[model samples]
Target chain A: MVNYLAGLDAVFLALADPTRRGMIERLSRGPATVGELGRPFAMTKPAITKHVRTLEQVGLVRRERIGRIHRCTLAPEAMRDAEEWIERHRRFWKSSLDRLTRHVESGDKLTLALTEERDE
Target chain B: MVNYLAGLDAVFLALADPTRRGMIERLSRGPATVGELGRPFAMTKPAITKHVRTLEQVGLVRRERIGRIHRCTLAPEAMRDAEEWIERHRRFWKSSLDRLTRHVESGDKLTLALTEERDE
Candidate 1:
């Protein structure tokens, strides 16, 4: 669980940046060289590299070097972890709300029973 | 879109902290007072308050003063935004992979046709 939370932390941090999200989107199409990844963004090569490194750190993207070229692909599995985390919490809250509704209904019934007993 | 991205940034940043995520989980059960929210954490009241404030800033939890107590409730809508963002990308990647598979299949067919023609 500690490792999972840590992985979640890294994933959220990596996703917080618009540029990084764009990179992930671009990579989703297929693997691309660093130059191809940087082409759409109006940023320096180092800036793009930093964003790529952040994605790599979170395991969101994988880099493989073929000759002098660095090819990056989207590691969708890492993204699945983040998605599952959010999905778990979303379901948690939904069930929680259901429970809260049931609790309130039971409380109302209990109150009604007490009032009837008092009157009797 | 910029506003949406900025909101996403705040939401992800707020969720990056385990403490804040815990508070969110606690709030999911139902509305709770500040004291109740702080009960699970080992941190000082002030520290817990800071985390609550961060969550409030991102609209993840709503705070309302009733009598002398402050009640915090899970604002699950904000969470939906984050979930939707991730879901969108997840779908994007899934479709992109489908397209890539089709492209590769077509390329293989084209290569086979050329080789057959050359042999003939």
Candidate 2:
């Protein structure tokens, strides 16, 4: 789980750059050949290729050759992993806040109750 | 939006380190003084202070000094931003796959229809 979170952080950071994120947004519509992916950017194909390679390293995108053209597609599973981890922990915070709210209103140990509920 | 996404990437990356993530996990249970937050790690308090400072920079935590004790609490909002962004795009991928599955089964332009569905 620890390593997985680190990988997710790497993937998202790789995607964080404008060029890389643009490549992904373009690829999302359909698979794109490397040259096609590069046309929108002012940078050279090699530069874009490096970005794609970084994305590939983090498992956010995959490349395959059809004839001489290398096509890229979104790798959705890693995105899902990141989403699920964030959602799980965010809910933990939300529930904690909710219990705090209830306790403040009613003068009760609602926080304790919520923890006990989780214990079951 | 682009800058916001970049910030999200930075924040998550900052949180990726084990010591940093450990600080967050502990903070989630309750607020902790800086010295208390550093006890689990073998590193010096200055090193741990640096980690906590990084977390604070990314808005994952807030530090408040009550007397000499610097207490840190989970910020929570930044985590929500990262979670929401990941979840929004992940659902996009899942729906794309579902459309692909249907198209493959029915031999129709389900992908096209899905794109059109988004247009509405």
Candidate 3:
């Protein structure tokens, strides 16, 4: 669990950049060469490489080499982890809200029951 | 569209920290005073304030001043936006993978057709 939380830190950090996010969006469609991934952005080659490295380090993007060519693709595991964290919290928040509603409704019912008893 | 993407950058950046995430997780359960939010971590007040500021700036958290105390709660909008972006891209990626599978399956069908024709 500790390692998973640590990975969440790196995953969100990697995704915090627009350019890197764009590259991931591109790779989501299909595998691409490093050059292909960088072509859509106006960033310099070094900047692109740095962004790619960050994504690779977070395990969100997989980069492999075949002789002279480099391929990059979406790895999905880190992305899934990040999604799960947000989703789990969302569920927690929703359930707590449900509990609060039930508590309030029960309070109202109790108040009504006491009023009826007093009238009788 | 651009403004929304810019918001995503800040949202993810704010979420990149473990302390901020812990605060968010706590806030999701219910509202808490600024001091209450800060009590979980063994950090200085300034550090906690900085993290809270980051979350507020990204709009993931809303902080309000009530009398002498400041209260914080999960805003949910930015978190929803983040979830939407991930879900949309996940759908895109899944569709693309399905297309690739169909393409390969069609290729296999063509090869089988040719093999049957030769046998006849």
Candidate 4:
């Protein structure tokens, strides 16, 4: 459980940056060399490399050296845990809201009955 | 676009902490008083308050005062933007993988044709 939380921490921290999110977006199209990933950004090569490193640390991207070029591809499965975490909460909240809706729709008869029992 | 990214940044940062995530989980079940929210953790009231503040900053929870007590409830809608952001990328990666599978299944005919055309 601790390790799971740590993984979530890393994933969320890695995704906190817009530059990193943009890199993921580009990688989603297909794989690309470091230079290609850096092209769309105004930052220097080292700066882009730093962002890529953060993503790699969180397992969001996998890098391979092909000749002198470093190619990066989206590690889609790394996102599964984070996606599932969010989805679980989303479903929970949705169901909670549904329950709340039903309670409200049922009106105050239950509340009144409980109050009467307490008074007795 | 910038504002949207900022929202994501805040949401992810807020979620990066396990304590905050735990509080969110509790809130998922129902509304709770500030004291109730702090009961499960070993942290001080101020520490818990700090976590709650971060969550509120991201609109993840809504707090209201009933007399001297503060009631906090999960603001599930606040999660909508973050959920959508992750879902979009998740869908993109899934489709990209599907395309890759099709390309590999089709074999090297396209690759050979491209190479021959380049040579000609």
Best candidate according to lDDT: 4
Per-residue lDDT over A24-57 for candidate 3, one digit per residue giving the tens place of the 0 to 100 score? 7877776666777777778798988888899899
Comparing 1 and 2 by DockQ, which wins? Answer: 1
Candidate with top TM-score is 4
Query: Candidate 3 on B1-120: residue-level lDDT in tens?
Result: 223478888888888889888888877776666667787778899998888888898888877675676756677667887877777677677765675456447864533322221211
Model 4's CAPRI class is acceptable
Per-candidate DockQ values are 0.31, 0.22, 0.27, 0.36
lDDT of 1 by residue, A20-70 (tens): 887777777666777777767789999989999999999988887756778
Determine which window of 10 residues in candidate 1 chain A has minimal summed lDDT.
A111-120
DockQ of 3: 0.27
TM-score of 1: 0.77
Chain B TM-score against the true chain B, candidate 3? 0.77
Off by over 4 Å in 4: A1-4, A98-120, B1-4, B98-120
lDDT of 4 by residue, B32-106 (tens): 666677777798999988988888889998887756767677886777777777778878987766755665478
RMSD of each: 8.3, 6.6, 9.9, 6.2
The value of fnat for model 1 is: 0.49
Candidate 2 residue-wise lDDT, B16-119, digit = tens: 57687677766666556677778777899889889989889889888766566675767778887667666666666766566445755885463343344232
Ranking of predictions according to lDDT? 4, 1, 3, 2
lDDT of 4 by residue, A36-120 (tens): 7777779999998899998998999988775676767788677777778777787789776665456547875434322321211
Global local distance difference test of model 1: 0.73
Instruction: TM-score winner between 2 and 3, please give it.
Output: 3
DockQ of 2: 0.22
Number of clashing pairs, model 3? 0
